[model samples]
Target: MTRPFPDDDSATLAAHLRRQAEEHRAKYVRAQSDRADKFVTSPRRVYELIRAGIRRGTMPHDQTLSEQHLIESLGATRNAVRKALQMLAEDGVLVRARRAGTSVVHDIVAVHDGEVGPRAWAGTPDEGRLTVDTLEISRISAPAVLQRLLGADTDSVLLLEQLGRMGGQPLYLRVGYCMTDATAEEFSQLIESNHTEFPPISVVHERLFGSAYGGSDYVVEAISCQERAAELLDMPVGAPVLLRELITRNSAGAPSELSYTHFRADRVAIVGSTLATTAASP
Candidate 1:
């Protein structure tokens, strides 16, 4: 709303009046949103909008979510928007608290392209509580890729399967195959003795070999979830998934471990960034 300026020759007075007007307008908006019984939007519709924003990477990833902004943008009642926020929190897409407000869980599994090794992507980058559960650790007959990458003499590789969860919701499943001289039982014993929960793969490598990895290479692709992975991730078979293939090398530049990570495509988004490049001269 616009109002005619007062007959005052002072610009300071005009600024003060504008500040007061803005404060009043904000309060009015909040008051209007508090009337939950009169809005046209339903709670489910508000949730869909929020879900779409998360899936499309349009929501703010680093900032606290604003209840007032959602209510105003969606023309939704306070209760409807509130329920939507709660739903996202339940789904592990957002973290909410009475005093902390709501915020998006931006990257449940995020890492930069240039980071060196499992040291780069092994740790967590999410906002909510995260847990890694060990599913299986066994010896598998070496696949053609592993044999070619590691060496022809590698007859069997150790398989380390894990499930990743955020806020109690399953988000990813990782199947890592390491070309190690140790047997499956020996590796399991080492993992148990090393840390309490499922430790990082690099830690296991260090525990077993007593050396740090040299570096790692990563390749990301889109794929359909197969039966075994779908069952663990709580998604339907044939659903979209993001596959991240990582190959960790020894200090001598020899490939040591090959890992495949599958993330729910709907809950994960990969952003590409270049830090070592510069713009052309003007």
Candidate 2:
């Protein structure tokens, strides 16, 4: 039964109907585009995308992740979503409780093969803000292992300990052994400034020599925490962690600095890549 409206009322009703129709059409078009985008991606790409998100700090620590949300936002299939979640869980980046669903315990790390300078890839703008707090800086005898690596007397190396936080949450514990002639006092300003790669090892190199480091070699593996690391990282002793042992090389290809960084397995994600030289995004 259609009740005839006054002329003015009819005009308003028609305009409202038109707006509703346009909105519906726009929503359908957007859904179709999202579907198309999802259909063209591979399973591997889905895994990488999830990893990329974690690296970009979008998947925050301890945040419950919804499978349906991931599927919808990523335009991925059910199987693809399940597979990605399983892989992440196995990688220690996520955990699934009995009814709580999957939750993030990982953050992203970009592994470009050089100093912490301009690199092949930059993360999306949402990447976590890392604040480094220098705990102790002392001119101490090098650890036995570092003494052998440095091939110099133990008395010369400077020890710098730091703790990294992302948005006030603990991220990593770093112990840097700098093979520089700079005094412990000289490194205070640099390390506290939180620049120069969590420790000013490179700055000392540049201040003494005229150029930057040649490169760095990283040996990464899964390890169980020891006393010091367990205490600072707030993890149980023998808890599994991702250990990155880095040796920074001078331009002459000689190792001048060494650092042991223990990253929280469930609170950090490491994404490594090689890039060809090209103009970066504007």
Candidate 3:
């Protein structure tokens, strides 16, 4: 044995052995990954779990979720918890501030039946709810936002401005914009007829496109009331208002209408629903 290994240098042998060890270790790591697919959960799934808990009211609003708590409870790594919290904060689901523990913000409303916008505003005829007054309907130059949102090739868009009221007091202002279509005029009439009814836009979609209701995405943000919005909503120009943007699509997956509604904080409460498992923040 000594005679056979006499020519082999120790450094050379060590390098060869190290290389083989690395190769085997790499193979073992890959094999572990393949075998652990069923056992390992992704960061995204952890995020969904937390979000669903918040939306479903399992996690109380304003309740802080600590990293250590989540790690111990969910069997998640520090990196996964951090990423999930970051995403939720970005989506306005959680408030993450310096020195402040992450907490849920919105009050989850179980909207089991209809879109929040139409349903919240719609009241029974006998209930003496808010009245919607159509202020103006005009054709205007398409804003960049509208063009991008609606995928509109034209430069013009139809705008409908309305004010919601209760007992002669202005409650909220709704400004609706739609991509130009041949049926716009007729649709406009229908909207005008039911402006006060708080009819869901789905009805309009069905009449205009001859298709069923698709769906909508809503964004809720705090905005300072501008002069136009202030006047329409009958609030001070600098007052804070809840701005809800509704982006509704057609059956063909094309954006059909966009609505910017300014709600008085004291007058209305917006309610939204979530799925049993997960919900994307507005």
Which candidate ranks first by TM-score, i.e. highest? 2
Q: For residue 177, what is the lDDT in candidate 1?
A: 82
Error of 3 at 242 (Å): 0.6
Pairs that clash in candidate 1: none
Query: How many residue pairs of model 2 clash at the backbone?
Result: 5
Better by lDDT, candidate 2 or 1: 1
Q: What's the residue-level lDDT of 100 in candidate 3?
A: 84
Clashing pairs in 2: 55-108, 105-266, 105-267, 107-268, 107-269
Clash statistics: count for each candidate: 0, 5, 0
Best by lDDT: 1
Name the candidate, 1 or 2, with the larger TM-score value.
Answer: 2
Model 1: CA > 4 A from native: 1-128, 143-145, 193-204, 270-273, 277-282
Root-mean-square deviation per candidate: 12.7, 15.6, 11.0
Instruction: List model 2 lDDT by residue over 1-282, tens digit each.
Output: 665566669887898889999999999999988777656245676788888788776887678888888888888887888888888887777887878789886555543343331121225342335666788888877667668876556566778788876656666888878877777887676554534333333564565434676777887799999998888888889998878888887888876677888887766555558769988999
Please list the C-alpha lDDT of all candidates, in the order they appear: 0.72, 0.71, 0.69
lDDT of 2: 0.71
